[model samples]
Target chain A: MRKLYLAGAGNVSKNLLSLISNLNSDIKIMGIENSRGQLFSEESLSMADINNFMKSPEDYRKSLNISKMDFDIYVDMRTASKNGERERDDYINLMKNGKHIVTANKSGLANFFPEIGKASSEFDKKLYFEATVAGGLPVFSLIRSSFPSFTVDSFTGVVNLTSNFVMKKVNDGMNLEEAKRKAMEEGVAETDMTDDLDGTDSARKAVIIANSLFHKPMRLKDLKYSGIDENNIKKNEMLLAKISMNKEFSVESRVFTLNSEDPFLRLAPMGMACSIGFKERNPVYISEDMDGPLETAGAVLSDILSV
Target chain B: MRKLYLAGAGNVSKNLLSLISNLNSDIKIMGIENSRGQLFSEESLSMADINNFMKSPEDYRKSLNISKMDFDIYVDMRTASKNGERERDDYINLMKNGKHIVTANKSGLANFFPEIGKASSEFDKKLYFEATVAGGLPVFSLIRSSFPSFTVDSFTGVVNLTSNFVMKKVNDGMNLEEAKRKAMEEGVAETDMTDDLDGTDSARKAVIIANSLFHKPMRLKDLKYSGIDENNIKKNEMLLAKISMNKEFSVESRVFTLNSEDPFLRLAPMGMACSIGFKERNPVYISEDMDGPLETAGAVLSDILSV
Candidate 1:
């Protein structure tokens, strides 16, 4: 039986915890952590206790005695934030402790690609992050598992769900402020909404894609990106943001408007879409018509099963 | 290191052999068989020998001294036909001999699922056929790898490329015969093209998808289907055919004309597309803009690596 540790008590983490119990009876959740605290158990946490723990803020992370504890896998489902930096450190430590890491946190990968790579290799720990970019759509794994022999010509996608929602609303005649407000109300956008609007989120996703698909290690700062918030367009200009990379494997992401007749210009408001082109075959298009939360959780669970 | 066997000399199989040499040096082709003949080697087949073996067909299959031979995996990339039953028997025998099987042949699974499933489990062999339905699209593996916990609500797709090609051509102001001829010229449709035009091909694909995605064991005879050839409609009524299934997990597929504004009706002539809905998340769309040659080979290589 595999023992698992979950980092973060956010909606995605909670959803993942709920799923792991029902899917595989042999695997047990050994611990859970959030910004406020953590709880560890030799026995699995009951559903009621899992929910209660999500709401509770008591720190019991150290109770298990980290140096002496043993678990097979550590899943990080935390969102990108300053808290994520600390989680990233913990992830490194967990890898050193011989815990296989599965993550939905882009910040963990986008910020520390080389360090994480070295640590995973040093400890012989397998690290996977399918949820980092377009988690709802299975683009990364498709390339990794299905089309490894094909030479990738290009990859382009609308990776940011919040910005996509805001843009769709703007196209429907809502002002930018109202659109952002609506995205927040729908629980798709964060309260600040800066990451979604400023292109950093998409840039981070682009970096992950470039690294995973093209073996091009890129930082979020290396991307040439421009956000949607900085632009003011007329009614005719309906802008959408996408992260794009060519055969050269350089990540270039920007917000732009396309003519209506372009086949690739179809957009979904609260979803993610991507097209991966190969040298030997036609492009593969993956489009997800869902918000981020459930898909993120699903992607995390997928990585868990993979590990 | 893995010992591999190629079970066909068709375009897709030949392409796969070409790719395996470049992609992974650890995997070696131990044998190859076609209707014309077979080739066997204890050592890896040289590139020259592989090409020569594909071109030369002098029956040496039984000469391998079956009782003395050993191989780890068998990949069946043969197209579905009368000869396929013999190949299916070979698959069963290979599994009985402890060879894990990967296939692109729908007939093997669609027709004899129970027998194949029993043989695989009884012998503890894995039978994977990711290249069976819409081999150009990574739908089955995507669902298997990406969404493990989500309950599938529905699966719908334009599974047959020939029918899609014909429909696109008819919409472009060509008669059915002309459209079919065009598809044949493009090598997307068979020379006879009866299976594609009569919906039998799509029905076989539906059976595969039903079994793989919905866990519904269905056969070609179980589906309600009508081919494009049986339909007669006005030129103004542009028509497209798609295979569709709902939460009932029953296969209800037919060819029909649709209203112009239906977004789902839009399709590429040489591509495959499918949308999968789940209980928790919104629908995920997988679109493939190519036929089964390179993509099918890619899918086979994927299953090969998986084993």
Candidate 2:
């Protein structure tokens, strides 16, 4: 029986749990530290609160009359690292104890990749987190598996869903605040969904691309992220209409913005970023393949699949 | 004979040339506007330039010593509508004559999707651009295929390769100047790659995506684009190593970043955008019956084989 441990049952975490029932029968959950409720229907080896379990696991599990649980992997589904002290240590501890770690918890990895890498190195454990960057997007494996012949100039994309939804609302003519509120109501975004506007999410995703695909674990503080949620674009409907994209086609992608702008003229109104594969004044479409934001993600997805 | 009338001899046009050989042997290139250098093969049809041929079809084809060359599909692969004054009349003219348009050009359809929809209502001319927003990504079909039951929340990715690369170079320690030069020299970039930097590239791709996938053609100007230029990054090799990604991964799907900072305590790093699926985030993978990015592309390749 392949025992697994899961930490922090947040939105994404809950989703992961629901999928576990469809998991290969070879895998089973033995422990989880979610307060909200159980996500995966595994035999609870330790139901004690994370705080108590982190400080002393034996006592916590003992109360439940469980002696020893065999967990092959640990999945951390927490979305952020703001105040997750025990969640962090507990995950680390599990990994140190010959257990692998797979997570959708991008925040945990972003802040502690180097240290985790160091520990995983010493402990000889594996860590996988495909859902960290893009929820369902296959980013990690893209870089991990690719064989180089083709050079990667850079990578960029809408890595943050909250902001993505917010941007979509703004394009739909809603004010920023209203758009944000709507995003949260839909559960696609949070109160702090504005963080995407600040570019922190995109930048964080960028950092991961840099390290995972480029073989560089960058310092988050060093990155300069500018979000699309700035004061400049309040509600430019005409521009939005002309450049706005229809939302009907992108049900999976769920993008809401117009992309029609005069390329010959120097005026640009779409969200974008850069990398090493472009120069001169290429058209946006051409530049996308030659120098667009989604390249790294595309490449990494490809890479991961090959691997 | 199955013939394809290639209109513009730009990237898609040229790329299509390469693709023709891979098609069924019965397919042929009946009327090429210009007898320019072969994109891949030396064999082709009417080699008259578009404008010149349009001016005096008989004279031009006569010059080439042709008896008859009736085209079934007028393949237009010109710069996007975001470009300068395109001859919309020419496209309409082709459609009026019952010629279908297969294009990678966004402007023609994006600029006039509604008009085209209305006109095609009566004319019954089909227009297709499989390589628009994310080249070779099957964006339009994906949306058209997955309708009503599915809802799109946001569409975001490293849409422009030039920008992705530029950011990669900046993270690599090369100043904007150096990265741009290298990109051009590498043939991974376009002549006017700078246009990619202004965010227009992504905007255009986004617009096309919005229109084709979402049925909402967004004006590029309305998009709140945020570009990552080199003035803000370092040219240090060490830093580059810290935040490096490869092109192969990004070119696959979305999610291409060097280091993804996790909101949760940094547990791991993975790039590639993921959408919330019914069960897992990689729903596209599952729904499409593919496991990951490699499978996605591989399946497409297989479809080509089966076809």
lDDT of 1 by residue, A1-307 (tens): 7788877778787667767766855678777777677777767666676667777657354464453466788887765664246656777888887789888888877776766777788888988888888865676666777777888768878788877677778778898789888998988887987877877788778777777666676666666777775346443233333434453435667665666654445555666777788877778878876656667787877777777
Best by DockQ: 1
Residue ranges of candidate 1 with Cα displaced over 4 Å? A42-52, A59-68, A83-87, A229-231, A234-247, A263-265, B59-68, B230-247
* Retained true contacts (fraction), each candidate: 0.83, 0.00
lDDT (Cα atoms) of all candidates against the true structure? 0.72, 0.44
User: What DockQ class does candidate 2 belong to?
Assistant: incorrect
lDDT of residue B91 for candidate 2: 62
Question: What's candidate 2's DockQ score?
Answer: 0.02
Q: Tell me the tens digit of each residue's lDDT in model 1 across B1-307.
A: 8788887889898778777867855888888877777887887688788778766676354464442366788888765764246656877888887789888888877776766777888999888888887776777667767787887767777778887688778777898778878998999977887777777777777777777666666666666776664346343222222334453446755665556644455556687877787877788887876776777888888778777
Chain B: TM-scores of all predictions: 0.90, 0.63
DockQ of predictions, in order shown? 0.73, 0.02
How far in Å is the alpha carbon of A31 misplaced in model 2?
Answer: 1.3
